[model samples]
Structure formats: C-alpha cells, structure tokens
Target: MRRTSLHDCPAPAKLNLFLHVNGRRADGYHLLQTVFQMVDHGDLLHFDLRADERIVRTTDVPGVPEQGDLIVRALLLLQAAYARRHGHPPQGIDVAIDKRLPMGGGLGGGSSDAATALMAANALWEAGFSREELMALALPLGADIPFFIFGQTAFAEGVGEALLPVEAPDCWYVVIEPGVAVPTAAIFCSEHLTRDTKPVRITDFSRHTMNRTDSTGFGKNDLQAVAVSLFPPVAQAIDWLSAHGDARMTGSGACVFCAFSSEAEADTVLQQVPGIWRAWKAKALMHHPLNTVLQVSAVIE
Candidate 1:
C-alpha cells in the first residue's frame, strides 16, 4: 500500500505590534508602517492530494462565500498558474481547516489561512514557484497575506507589502477578543482617521520611545483613533486589558493584547478576563510556524 502523503500545516495569526499611517496612495490605498509578529494561537490546516483535478474544501467555513474563500481562491490561483506554465492541470487537493483564530479580530487568521493554502498547494502540486513569486500572488489576497508567505517577524511598510525581517524578543501575549466585528474599511475611511503622522527609521526603534520592546517605533495606527471612537467595545477591551498589563490594540480594532514576562503572568490576566469575553494566552513568535514546517519537510524529503 502507498504511504499516505499527509500534509498538516499551521495557519498562525499575527499581532500588529504597532501600526502607523503616514500617507495615502494616489490610488486611494493608505500608506502604513507596522511590525507584524506571529503568534502561537491560530487556525490549523490539513491537506490531502486528490486524484481529481478539481480543488475542494473538505471543511465547511461559514459566512465566507464559496468563490471568495481565500483558501479556495488560493488553490485556484496556483492551479491556473501551474496549468498555464506546465501545459496540464495540476493535481487537486482537499483542504481541511480547523478554525481557532476568531474572525474579524484583527488576528490575521484569514490571511494566514490563505498563505497556508498557497504554500501547501504549491508543495502538493509540485509547482516550482519561488517564495518571491508566491508572495506576489499573495498580495492581492490581503494586505497581511504576503508576510505569512515570508513567514517571519517583519517590519512592514508601503501599505504592508514591503517586508524587512526582524529578530523580536520572545514574550507572552494576553489576547482579548471583545466578541464583536470591527469593520476594517470603515475604520480606514472614517473622517476621524489620522493620516499625517511622521515616519521613523527601522533602526531608530528603541525601548525608550514606546517603552515597548516588541513593537517597531515607526508609528501608531492611524485608524486606531477612529476605531476607538466608533467602537466602544474595542476601547473597553483595551482599557480592561491594560489594567492588568501593558495593553495595546492590535491591527485596526476589536482585539487588544497585553504583554507579560511569563506564561504564568499571562495566564493570570487570562483568568481575570470575564468568561463572556474571548481570551487567550499565547506566546509571541519571532518567526512564522509555516517556515519551520517547510524547512522540516525539505529535510525529510
């Protein structure tokens, strides 16, 4: 009997250590600078190659359209590209996603899933696309998608596509999800959004600036003020988390996190959070878990 080619992959969520909007593009996209740190808490994906040439999702993902599911779209994108280049359709794969990261929590769960699909499909299909090429495809999927393709802690700039790998300290995070969805575009488009903050150099980031070691001192989230003003739940979450430790809003809004020196400390905060609110204690990752998975697979093969 042929050995089953089991491919299990992780879709890690990200925390925006800090986000600053300094400008807006001519095409209406906002210019930004942020540090993206991967976290241990996220959704999981498992893949199995299929004999048929059609991509299928074995797991049901509600509230996401069939055609628009990032995983499905990512598979199709790779399939079409492989067909065009290789003169034949690539073998299809059945994708199973075990969702853990909360949706619309600014955890980059969706983008991470999309990246996992891209990486897994590329491997399963035997496509010879380089990481750079894969990231190019990832960009249109979501602003946060490309970083997962790179799979490392990065100082992101230029609407979050430009990446510079950074070595971040290992730390524990207390993430609190207020159980509400904050519209990202609405926050960005708000009249109250700040768009004229000055930018800082990557090397200039120091502990004294923000008194925070995990964030890039480049800037603050331009959308944060707008998010906090419009969404009282977000503000409440931030205030609640900050009362225990150093708390900051991740991404646009809806999720706020506190940093702790130890897992025990994080657990303490996690316990204090009300049972009605969604909360987790996860470690900050300096690199993406997917990268480690890929590297190990290479060695195994």
Candidate 2:
C-alpha cells in the first residue's frame, strides 16, 4: 500500500543552552558556537501528497505568507535538489503547520518546522535521501535547520551548521514567552553586540552537568545583554524568572528559561507565571521525537 500522507509530525523547538559569538566572517556572517537543546514543546505538521508538481500550504500561518513560509520553501528546495540528482521532480506536497511555538521567541519554531517538512517530504515522496544529505540541503534555508535535521542535542559551530552530538542533561524547563518579536538580524547587527566572547572548548561545557543543585552554570548567552537592553519585556521576564533559578534568554531574545531537576519543580514555576505572558513546562529531549522515522526513505508506488 502506498502511503499518501504523514500526519502529526512534530517540529520541536530548541533552546540555546549557551550561545557565544566567536568572530565575523568575510561574508559579514557572525561566527557562533552554541549548544542546542531540544525541548518537547513545539509545533506539529501534516503532509499530504499531491498528484502534480504544485507545492502548496494548506493552512494559513499568521504573518507568514504561503510562498515565504519556510515549510513551503523547504519542500521547493528538496524538490529542486532531487530533480538535480534524479533528473525528475517528485510529487508535490501540501503542508499544514499546527503553529504553537511563539514567533521570534528564540525557540527555533520556523527552522524546526522547515526541518520536519523536509524529513516528512522525503518519506512521503520516497526520495531516499540520507540524513546527511538532508542536513546539507537544509543548511542554505537557515542555520538552525541543520541542527534539527541532525536530530540530537548538538554542539554547533560555523554559522550553526557544523554539528557534534553531545549529551544534554535530562531535565525540565520552564519557558516564558515575552510578548515581543526580537529580530535576529537586528540583534546581530547592533554595535553593542558582543562579537568576540573568547570561545571555549567542548570539554569546558561537557564538564558541567546541569541540575538543580549545580550553582556554577555553563557559559552565558553573549547576546543576552543586547536583547535585554533592547526589549524591556525580556528583561522583566528574566528578572522575574531568575528568582526561581538562573534564567537566561534563549537564542536572540524574547523568551527566558530556567532549568529544574524535576517536572514538578518546573510546573510550580509555570503556574506562577504572570497572566500577561505565555509559559509552559517541557522535558528536555536528547533527540528529536521523529528520529526513528527519518531513515532512508524508499519510493512507494
């Protein structure tokens, strides 16, 4: 039997346990080193195959046009990549995103959605592309997309494409979403941004086991200060959450998170979050939930 759809595919969000800016490239892109930790809370996607080579998005995502949506772009990219290799385009797909994660909250929502679309499209189209191929194909779309395709908690470098799987502590996180969108480009281009933070070796981070009792936390996010200064809501959220523990802004800004030893500890804080902001508790996921299904997809007819 031919499978025509892949429903309820998860596109889990990620937290930058710590983000450091190493330097700037000749291309003006900032070099970075970050540990991306996958959290269980994120968006979901559904893919339905089409008979013709007409890519479409079945659902409307607020603020994201159909053509500009990363999910649609990912499908187009994959289709072009496949056509270049196989001399023929695969069938089109209709992707519906169950958008849950906050936009521009440093949660990697869009990039994660793009990665899931690529993975699910490979399976439904039976493109037979390997994980490495998919990662490479996904890189041009966004730096964070490859990390999601890597399907593990990873230590990432070089514009966040180079990846090495690392062990992340099994813990829970209480994330607070400040009602603001922190633009990534704006944060990176700011004169006050820290471009050189004295890069640390992987061993430096691997030595620290994150838990409730560990007082000496890992490296701090270098972009936090800039984001905090630019967004007052971010600063307020962090100031409040820090009372519970060491809370820091995730990637660029607008979301702050604190790690706890148990779900109960996280929930206690989640319940106390102010009504003005959105909050949730999620367990740390060492690997992606859909990792098992991301094998070499075989063509089905």
Candidate 3:
C-alpha cells in the first residue's frame, strides 16, 4: 500500500540524565558522556508527500525560519542522499510541527524533530535505508539527531555520537521552563565551564539511584554550573525545585528537572512550581514511540 502522509508523529523530548564533559577536541567540539532518556513530552509532526519534489514546512515555528528549520534541512539531506544512492530523489515532503518543547532548553527538540522527519519519510517512501544508515545520515545534521534515531535510552560519548543502549530507571520528572533560552555555544565557551571532569564508565552510572528522590550520588551535568552562573532565572528555578528533590538543569538549559519515584510525587512538585515559570510532569520512556516503524537492526558502534 502506498502511503502519502503521516500525521501526529511524535518527536519526543530527552533529558540528559547526566552530562559530563570529559575534555575538548582539538577541533573545538567538547567531549561528553551523557545518558539520554526520552520522555513522553515533545513536539508532534505531520508529513505529507509532495508530488512537486520540493521540501516545505507548512507551519511557522516561532523564532525558526522555514529554510533554517532542521526539519527542512533533514528532508533535503535525505532527498539528496537518496538521489545519489538510487539515481533519483525521494519524493519531497511537507512537514508541520506542533512545537511543545522550548528551544535552547537542551531537550533535543530540534534534533528529535529532524530525526522523526527522516524516519517518517523513509517509511512513507519505502526507502530501504537501514536504521544504521539513517543514523549515519543524521549525524552531520546534529550530534543529538543520531541519538534520537538510535531510538533507545542510551549512554552516549564522543560529542554524543557514540551510543550504547542502556537502561534508564522507570521514573517521573518535574520539568520547569525558566523562561530564558540558554545558548549552547555560550555555555560551552564559558571560562567557568568544567572541561576536564574525569571520564567514568557506563557501569559507574548505577540505575539503582535513578528512581531515588536524592539525586546526590549521581554524576552531575557539567554544563549546569555554567548555565546557572550565566542565567539567573535558571539558577532560581533550580533553587526553587531543589527543595523537592535533587533538582538539576537538563542540557545547557533554561529548563531544570528533578526525578521522582512516583507520578504523585512529581505532580506535587509540579503543582507547587512558581506561577512565573511553565512546568509539567513527564514519565521516562525506555524507547522512542516510533521505534517499531524501523524494520532493520544493526548495532550502534
């Protein structure tokens, strides 16, 4: 059966359960190790095949120009790659984004959206690219894009490209948006940023503590201190949320989160969050909702 469109495709958000900056590459990319845990909250996307072979976005995304949008760039990249491999471009796509995640919040929303576009297009066009092939194609777009395509809770290293599937404990989170976008470049470039945390093995991150209210023993996000120093609102949010648990900023953020063992605990904190910031509770997901769509299996190196 030929499918012309995919509607309500989910592009779930992720929390860096912990991000450690191991060092810096000579090329200026930071070496990092983090556990990426997908959450139920994220943007939704709709894709329609375009007979004209022109990739387009049908809706306006705040602060993102159509051409600059990652969704468009992802489709074009796929289209070009498909043409080179198969002697003809894959049919174009029109994408609509239902944006939920905040930009620059370190939630990997844009990367997730691009990954969803690539996967959904591949399935709709019956493109035979393997999951690994799709992930490879996704890398040059964004480091986080490949992780989204990897489609599982992952322990990642090497500028976040090296991925190994790992278990993230089942838990709930109280995520707060602090109303400011923390630029990733600024956080990474800050002199105050910790660039030399001793690297730890995957086993060092025990899943046993993941569901505990005290996140104290867990590895920390190296970027969080820099983010807090630069963005006062982020610090404020973190301070406010910490009363409930071991609250920490996720990603490079303007958002901070704390884990809870039960939905009720997370919800209680969510209700008490100051009216000045937007907040919600989300459950950890072991795999991407779209994981079943990919029919191929290949180990991630």
lDDT string, candidate 2, 94-188, tens digits: 88878899888999999999999998888887788888899898888899998898888888888999888877788899999999999998899
**Model 2 TM-score, all chains together:** 0.95
Q: What C-alpha lDDT do the candidate models reach, one value each? A: 0.80, 0.88, 0.87
What TM-score would you give candidate 1 relative to the actual structure? 0.92
**CA-RMSD of model 3:** 2.0
Which whole-number lDDT from 0 to 100 does residue 197 have in model 3? 90
Candidate 1 vs candidate 3, lDDT winner:
3
lDDT (tens digit, per residue) of candidate 1 on 1-301: 4322446688988988778889898999999988888989898899888888978888888888767788898889888989998999987788888999877788888899999889877776778887888889878878899888887878889989998876566778888888888878888888788888788667755433344543323345566678888888888887887788567778887788877767888888888898878898888886667767666331100
Where is the poorest 10-residue window by lDDT in model 2? 292-301
lDDT of model 3, residue 277: 97
As a whole number from 0 to 100, the lDDT of residue 286 in candidate 3 is 78
Question: Following a full C-alpha superposition, what root-mean-square deviation does model 1 have from the true structure?
Answer: 3.2
- Predicted structure 1: lDDT: 0.80
In order, how many clashes per candidate? 2, 0, 0
